[model samples]
Target: MLMSGSVSLYTDKASLYDVDYLSKDYAVEATFLQQLICNAIQYSPAEKPHLLDVACGTGNHLQFLQEMFVCTGIDLNSSMLAIAKQKIPQAIFQQADMTNFDLAEKFDVIICLFSSLYYLLDTALITRTLQMFVRHLTSNGMIIIEPWLTPDKYEEGKCAVQANQTANVSLTRLSVSRRQRDVALIDMYYTVYDGKNVTSFQDTHAFLLLPHTVLQGIFDSLGYATEVIMKAPFQERGLIVAKAK
Candidate 1:
């Protein structure tokens, strides 16, 4: 059986999460976001902006978000946060749920990347999470959400393989995901070989396959200045950019 919806694949794989995701071209992503911010606000923040990355995972994006904004990361997994802390000790990290969290400070930019929002799994949870993002943003802040695949875009029983090797450690991941009704049911198998030892584990993840119109409706109902950019990373799943009304 799949575990609770709150389960994170990174709970045990935090060490390698950085090695995998951090290697992506984050500078390009950063540049894109910067342009979005400029186009949205028509000016750069006068001072270093405070950025909050919801469901930040292993803080791969933080390395670039921190370049233009002071960065803070929040994730559901403590192990992930621990690894993120070590990787970017200068930034702040917290273990917090995206659907509900309280931060004393508001952020100039809030982001949830890599289809993490779909983990909310239902309209109620997703709405509450959108409220959380709005509540945490400054007066002029923008929220950038990278959505997951819609039902039509999702491939059933899709499989992918990834492997990385270093002098002391070798790691491999095999993932397969299929739609279970309105959710994407994913099974990920990971194996790590550290020369002297070997370990393996599996994690199951669930993502809500929300329709595009429904997501846009949420933004419209919230009365935000909303725009969906078609040219985004990751198979052009699209990006949702919103600002408070």
Candidate 2:
């Protein structure tokens, strides 16, 4: 299980995650991501790319990426990986930290999406992880990331409530964000009513508000050409694609 950072939310409660993002269009996001990878890989080409998904929470993106590429996913949360494995049985899923993992293989495309990098919360670890991403690339590989909010984009005291239900189960999560210096501290309360039973839990996630320049600087220093694409499925955020030079 993830011992710290934003992964904490999924550590024990992977089942709740799908319900949390029930409104998100992962298929559409995956389509956009495929286009992003398509444009970024002109410098290097692969007929059938081997894609590594870092912090793949529930294989939502990989579900679609697997249709187009050979997919492998890694996440710190075992519970999350369980759901991911069940979804993409054809793909490989492993439990590993973003900063420290050795698959002993390289991929043509590496992706860490849905603001996953913000969970690193440490500059050194972030750089180290990006270095690992570079190391795991096939020299022609491209990296795509969806970032968390920057300082200017982050607003404190924002609250979001999401609820989803099926015939047997109902899940609801109340989330609120607060600022702690460069960190966004989010507190989540989840309630699950499974017809015959009721359970409730609280999870807190802390995400780093790393600036775009700082992120791009690490990519640039690693001999990557970084660009921030203004278009994305999420209106509140954008995608960052960095290609090997």
Candidate 3:
């Protein structure tokens, strides 16, 4: 059971991040993104396309994406970036914020996955982040995002729990969903057993319930072509794929 305490997942708990999400099928998600890129940039007889992952925590996707593209990842958390850099030394890793980052170079594809966009907390920031991504994209570049649950699909007051363990570490996550207007507040409690000791902490994650219609409008207003694919990695979470008009 989790007790009353708070810890930074981006800092002291960063090493356990991978253990918490050990079951996530990064390979399948990478394959899906690869297919999308292939279809979008068909027959490009140039060097390998450049790919930028914004708010790319720990570079899980980059591990596989690097095989097809020149991968670059940026995250605001230095700890996460450190882990990512150690994992994929061949790829570029930087500490950056998604809303206002300038890489001074263009990418053939820019991705923000794992619903990281929701951390922006509002429609305006979402738009600002998209614009920033657009600025760093090549002429025909595309942006792919795995969005958080939309307003219509969000189930308020829901409880969810997950447990995972390895040879030396055990992790259990219990989360409850609540809402404050457009933001979905997930109160998460985590308890870990590392064979020798036990520890527990709590964290609250607020994600803006970005509606698909609003997302489409934002893309339309920005003069971009967009599509919302409902059948994405997390099923109901959906995906937003966009390209400059």
- Please list the C-alpha lDDT of all candidates, in the order they appear: 0.81, 0.86, 0.88
What's the CA error at residue 147 for candidate 2, in Å? 0.8
Clashing pairs in 1: none
Residue by residue across 135-157, what tens digits does model 3's lDDT show? Answer: 89888889998888888889988
What's the candidate order when arranged by decreasing lDDT? Answer: 3, 2, 1
For model 1, residues 1-245, the per-residue Cα lDDT tens digits are 22232234577557777554535676787778877876775335577888899988877788777777789999999998887788789999999999889988898889898889998889888988888888888888899998988888889888998888877778777899978789998887777687877767777888999877888788778777777887744446788888878
Instruction: Tell how far residue 195 is off in model 1, in angstroms.
Output: 1.5
Candidate 3 Cα deviation (angstroms), residue 82: 0.9
Ranking by TM-score: 3, 2, 1
Cα lDDT, model 1, residue 32: 86
Off by over 4 Å in 3: 1-4, 43-46, 232-234
Ten residues in a row with the worst lDDT in model 3?
1-10
**Collision count for each candidate, in order:** 0, 0, 0
Query: Clashes in candidate 2: how many?
Result: 0
lDDT per residue, candidate 2, 6-118, as tens digits? 33458666777887788889999999888877776653244678999999999999999998889999999899999999999999999999999999999989999889988
Of the two candidates 1 and 2, the one with more favorable TM-score, higher being better, is 2
Number of clashes in model 1?
Answer: 0
TM-score, structure 3 vs. true:
0.95
